[model samples]
Target: MDNLTHSLVGALIGQTGLKRKTGLNIPALIIGANLPDVDAACFFWLEGVEHLGFRRGITHGPPAWLLLPLVLAGMLWGFDRWQAKRGKRPEGRVPVHFGWLYLLGFIACLTHPALDWLNVYGIRLLEPFSSQWFYGDTLFIIDVWLWGLMGFATWWSLRQEKRGETWRKTGRQALALALVYIGVNGAISTYVASSAQAANPQATQVIASPLPVTSWDREVLLKVDYGYWAHVESSARQDLARPNKISVSPCRLSTATAGANSQLDAFLFWSRALIAERAEDGSVILRDARFYDPRARDRFSLALPDVECEPLAPPSP
Candidate 1:
């Protein structure tokens, strides 16, 4: 999920009665929520698809989940002390406690991966221990509906806080509602994927990715023996059994274990539904069917000259 969503979730978590636990509660929540994204710094040194392989890895792993919050909490605790020493601390700021700060950070950090897992872009929950990727495929990376829900809830809770009314329950209710929304979406994803599998009995794998702006519409990708199949199916459509459009392409998986370049290697590594084609000049062109777009050709693709391309017949005049 995007940082905004992460930050909002952190804020909501803090407002759910955690903020009163520590002086730097909000900081711990918000910072911890986005802490796993420290892996994004890989982009600074790594180039292109290298980021893909490095990101959502170590930082999002089980060990990091346990330790990153401690790091963030320590920093926040130090910052507060430094502010006090410099006499720049706010007058209304409450005394900070290390334990409460760590707890808040931990709670916020935990939510980061959970929300990330809900999206199509996979997360490495067991990163250092295992490089396996897990996908919920329940929601889009950035769901406007979620933004609205979290935004409205945060705003309303703040208003209640200012009015000196009990606002903790408001935040709790918002979190409950958000959980319900995610649960419903998860069920829908499972239904859509099952329906697609039923339609294509030969499909080895069925990935049902939720489409933005639709509650029950999904772009289903199926890996068949021949190549791959893609279609857009909607549960709300009159014909739930039929997909809106079905596109099938025939190609073989690349024999090369590694890509010609880091970019291609990273893309291939991250791609779940990979498609490959033999180019005319004995090059291998690879694409991830998940991001397949005819109009925006080669957007999520890489060309490898070193990888052998299957022989093709010459065109007759």
Candidate 2:
């Protein structure tokens, strides 16, 4: 999920009466919600597709979940003391409770991974312990509907707060609605996956990727022996009658070249449904079936240069 969604979720959580727990409870919630994304810094040091292999890994795992909130609590405690020393602490602020801060931080931080897991981009829930990627295939990476739902609720809650009216109820309602929306989408994905599998028994894997604008629409990708099959499906239509075949001969690189190119290796490690094709220039163009876009050629693609490409035989039908 996008950082905006994460921040909004954190704020919503705070608005549900958790902000009253401590002086910096809101800040802790908001910051902790985005803390797992600190791994994004890998972009500065890692080039090309290397960040893909590193991101949503160790940071989104159990160890960081346990330790990050503690670190945040300590920082908030230090900041509170610093403010007191400078006599700049807010006069109306509630007493800062370290325990409450840690607990709130933990709660907010947990939402980050949970939301992240709902998209096809995938998350490493048990990273470091296991490098396996998990996908929810429920929602788009950035859903306008979610933005509207949570955004309105958060804004309305704050408005109610300013007017000294009941505010927590709005947040709670929004949270419930969001969960219901997620559940509906999950069911849709599950149905689509089952339909695809039933339609094509040869499919080894299937992904029901949610579209950006239409909540009911999904771009389904199925991995088969030859290559992949892709098509759009909606809640109104569950049939997989015809799908565009993305047929490409598998290009295998020599062990030496594969091990030497860090960028190629990283892309291979991250790509769940990988497809390799030999370009006209003899370079190997690597792509993932889930994110490949023909119009935008370079987005989710990596080209390996000066590598010997051997086209493998397609599996017998």
Candidate 3:
């Protein structure tokens, strides 16, 4: 999820907690919740250092979670002590019930990684030790539904609270809607993925990509069981057009197909099922199709020669 989405969720949780109980340090809690994303700052100031490699490393690892409570506690102590020394009411021990602050921070930061996982670029949540990249391939990196839910919840809660309305009415309703949307989105993604997989049981590696294409209904990423062959493609199946064009791998399947069966047939099946335009070269092209730009093939050539430019031209029509 994006910053605004994270912030809205954090604020909503904060508001709900405050509404239910007394003594939460809402501001500090909210700040701590968003601290993990401080990594985003590196993208601008640190350049290649930020997300280029370290996006979901130690910061998102399981071990880092243990230190959060301690870190929050120490931060709380220091801030209060400073306030007291300055002759002010030291924010008074931050309502003990607010210790749930740890959970708040955890969930908030967790959302960051979870959302990133939805993107094509993988997130190494279990880094160093386990660099195996994992992707949800479910939701889009930033969903408009998430944004609207979080924003509406925060707004509705604040406004209703101002009018002395019940928090349960506005706040809970918003959270419920968000959860429902996530659920529905997840179910649809899973069904599509399962269908792609069943379409080709022999595929060595299957990457189901619903994003990175336009007007294009589905894009499936596949790795065949043959010659280390792979592909990133999109294809079409239309209701009105009988026997419309489709491929085992279609987005860039411009490659001639005489020897198409050379690559593992399994991966090729999914590729053809999902492809629209085969690559000019039969080789797999690993590139982000997010922009759906008509000229993406040309652009991909610049960065991914191995996957994009290698010409394993399909044998023949």
Stretches of candidate 2 exceeding 4 Å from the true structure: 233-239, 247-257, 294-297, 312-317
Which candidate would rank higher by TM-score, 1 or 2?
Answer: 2
lDDT of 1: 0.80
Best by TM-score: 2
Candidate 1 lDDT tens digits, 1-317: 99999999999998888898779889899999999999887868986556766778888888988899999989999999999999999999888999999988888888998988997779889988898999999998888888999999999999999999999999999999999999999998998888878876767788888888785577777665555454555555634344432342335655565645678768867888777766767667777777777863455677667676443332121
Q: What is the C-alpha local distance difference test score of each model?
A: 0.80, 0.86, 0.51
Q: Model 2: per-residue lDDT, tens digit, 195-302? A: 877887878888888988897788878776655445545535656745556666566556676667788778878888787778887778888888777864576788
lDDT-based ranking: 2, 1, 3
Our tally of clashes for model 2 stands at: 0
Off by over 4 Å in 1: 233-235, 238-250, 257-261, 279-282, 294-299, 311-317
By the TM-score metric, which is better: model 2 or model 3? 2
- TM-score ranking of the models: 2, 1, 3
Q: How many collisions per candidate?
A: 0, 0, 29
